[model samples]
Target: MHYVNAKGILSNKNGMNLYRGCTHGCIYCDSRSNVYNMDHAFEDIEIKANATELLKKALKNKKEKVMIGTGSMTDPYIPLEKKIQSVRESLELINKYGHGFTCITKSNLVLRDLDLLKEINEKAKVVIQMTLTTYDEDLCKILEPNVCTTKERVKVLKILNKHDIPTVVWLCPILPFINDTEENINGILDYCIDSNVKGIICFGMGMTLREGNREYFYSKLDKQFPGLKEKYIKTYGNNYGIASPNQKELMKIFYKRTNENKIMNNPDEIFEYLHEFPSKDKTKQTTLF
Candidate 1:
């Protein structure tokens, strides 16, 4: 782990990444793509040493309260987070300023901040978004190694649901012939149903592979699935989005299940929901009546 001063903390959309690079080791991690231009090794972990300070200033001076988001570039709950507590500190700032908060992560460590999440949710809105790729435990390990398995994540989701904290699940990157099966989809969807998730975001039954990630994914595929790399080459070539052969069928299953469970299934709808902020206490009251 290392620290570097960042010019700014929040992005144009009010999103911030307290850390750069991730160690979760998701072979299909899109963040590993060269487009992001990460300077350090993927697992080296770069800390924005002043993220909390910058965030405090940004929130303190904001003309209006809005949803503060993070974990789009890297999971904010990585192991280093336990040692550094940057995410927690930033959350404190967001809560202190009466701003809504949301984060996308794949770790159960978010449980540690459940009280803060609940506080924000009560005063404003707090959404906990978790990515669920494979329902099978063993497959989850290979895909998202070094993080808590899907089962543990489900428990966290259920806990949030019990606290009335809205939860969204991202069921994505369904690799062809690996985890695109109906059983896998149903298994994960079942967890969503059981946990009473408010929404689910899935682009499609596919995964994107580019210069950096494609090589790593293919290399891992070669090591674990033998002959899978050749199959991917023959199937996808240099294309980016590799759709599952069962995309149509799997999508049908997804729509049917989500509709029956009353969970938001459209990616656009979920994204819009996450970005929208509640106007609670938006304008300062003149009197303390």
Candidate 2:
């Protein structure tokens, strides 16, 4: 891990990434793509040394209370977070300033800040977003080796639900020829249903492969699943969108299950929910003149 003096912390939309790069060795990570242009190795996490300070300042100066999000390009609950507590500090700032909060993470480390999340939800709102790519515990280990397994993440979701905190699930980057199957999709959906997640965001039944990420993914495929790399090359051949051959059928199951469970499935609608901050205004009392 390394540190840098950052000029700013929050994005135009109030999104924050306390660190750059990641240690979670997910083979299909799109952040590894050269298009992002990271100067350091992906595992050498770049810590924003001034993230909490900048966030404190940003929240203090902001004119309106709005939802502040994180974990877009990098998961805020990465292993380094256990030591730095940057995300936890930022959450304190958000709660202190009466602003809503949300984040997307695959790790169960987020449960550490459950107290602050509840406080923020009571004052404004706190929506926890988790990514569940694979349901099978053994397969989850192979896919996201550095982080906690999917079952542990599900436990986090259930805990948040028990606290009456809303949760959303990002069911994405479904690698073709690997986990694109009815059993896998159904298993994950069952978890979402049981967790009582407010929504499930799934763009499609397949994942994306690009310049830098493609090479890395192919390399991992060769290492973990020998000869599978050749199959991807023969099928995709440098295509950016590697849609699953079973995309149509898998999507059919996705919509059917989410709709049946009353879980929001539309990406746009779910995003709107994530961005919306609750109004804290109380009804004014009337006095007779």
Candidate 3:
């Protein structure tokens, strides 16, 4: 882990990455892709030492409150976060200034901030976006080695639902031959349905493989799956979008199940929901006496 003095915190879209790179060790992490030009090792987390100060200033200066999002490029609740407390402090600042909060993570450590999330939701909104790629426990361990498994993530989602904090699921990076089967799709959707997630964001029934991540993913495949790397190379042949052969059938299941459950499956609509701030009057009314 390393620290750097950051010049800014939030993006123009009001999203922030408190850390650079990751430690979750997901085999298909897009952040590791060369397009991002990360200078450090993938697991060596880059902490924005001054992120909190920059965030406080940014939030204070904003004329209107907006949803503050994180964990787009890096999961905010990575293991190192347990000690750094950067995410916790960011939440405290967001709650202090009365801004909505949303984060994408695969860690159960999010439960530790339940109190703050609930507080912010009461005033504005707090959406927890979790990624669930594989439903099988053993496969989930192999695909997303370091983070909490799918069942634990589902449990976290259910807990968030019970607390009245809305949740969304990112059902993505579905490795073609590895986890793109109808069974895998159905299993993950079942978890979403049981959890009562507000939405499920899936970018089709496939994953991408660019320069950096493609190489890393192939290496892991060679070690874990054995002979799968040769198959991927032959099948994909340097293509970016690695679509599943079962994409059509699996997407049918994805749409049918999500529609029947009334969960939002449209990415644009879900993103709009995540970004939209609650009406100020509604927030003011909550505290009115």
Candidate 4:
């Protein structure tokens, strides 16, 4: 791990990445693509040394209160977070400024900030988003090796639900010929339903492959799924979106299950929910006045 002073923290859209690069060895990580242009190795995490301070400054200058998001390019709750505590400090700042908070992560370590999240939700809003790629515990280990497994993530969702904090799940990157199956989709959907997640974001039933990530993905496939690299090359040579042959079938199951469960399934709609700051506190104050 390494540290670097960041010029700025929040994006124009109110998102920030406290770290650059990730240790989670997910083979299909798009952040490794040449399009992102990282100067260091992917595992050598670059800490944004002044992220919390910059975030505080940004929040203070905002014209109106809005949700602040993180963990887009890298999970904020990565193992290294246990030491840096940047995410925790950022949450404290968001709560201090009365801004809503949301983040996308696969780590159960998010539970460490339950107190801050609850406090923020009571004041404004706090939504926890988790990514669930495969349902089978063994397959989940293979896909998202460095982070918490699917079952453990589901437990986090359930616990958040019990606390009345809404949650969303990213059901994506379903590797073609590996995890793109009816059983896999149904199993993950069952977990979402049981946990009462507010929504599920799925960009279809496939993962993307590009110059940098594609090469790394193929290398891992050769080692883990032997012969799969050749199949991918033969089928998707130079293509960006490596969609699954079962995309239509799996999507049918996804839409059917999420719709029946009353969970938001549309990507645009789910994003709106994540970005929208609730007015419950404001309404209560107005009512009292």
Model 2, 240-280: lDDT tens per residue? 88899999999999999999989999998888888887664
lDDT of 3 by residue, 73-161 (tens): 99999999989999999999999998889899999999999989999999878999999999999999999999999999999999999
TM-score of structure candidate 1: 0.96
Q: Taking the tens digit of each residue's C-alpha lDDT, what string does model 1 give over 86-117?
A: 99998888889998888999999999999899
Point out the worst 10-residue segment of candidate 3 by lDDT. 280-289
Cα deviation of 57 in candidate 1 (Å)? 0.5
* Cα lDDT tens digits for candidate 4, 137-190: 998888789998999999999999999999999998899999999999999999
Backbone clashes in model 4: 0
TM per candidate comes to 0.96, 0.96, 0.96, 0.96
Worst ten in a row by lDDT for model 4: 280-289
- As for lDDT, the candidate ahead, 1 or 4, is 1
- Against the true structure, candidate 4 reaches a TM-score of 0.96
The C-alpha local distance difference test score for the whole of candidate 4 amounts to 0.89
Runs off by more than 4 Å, candidate 3: 281-289
- Per candidate, the number of residue pairs that clash is 0, 0, 0, 0
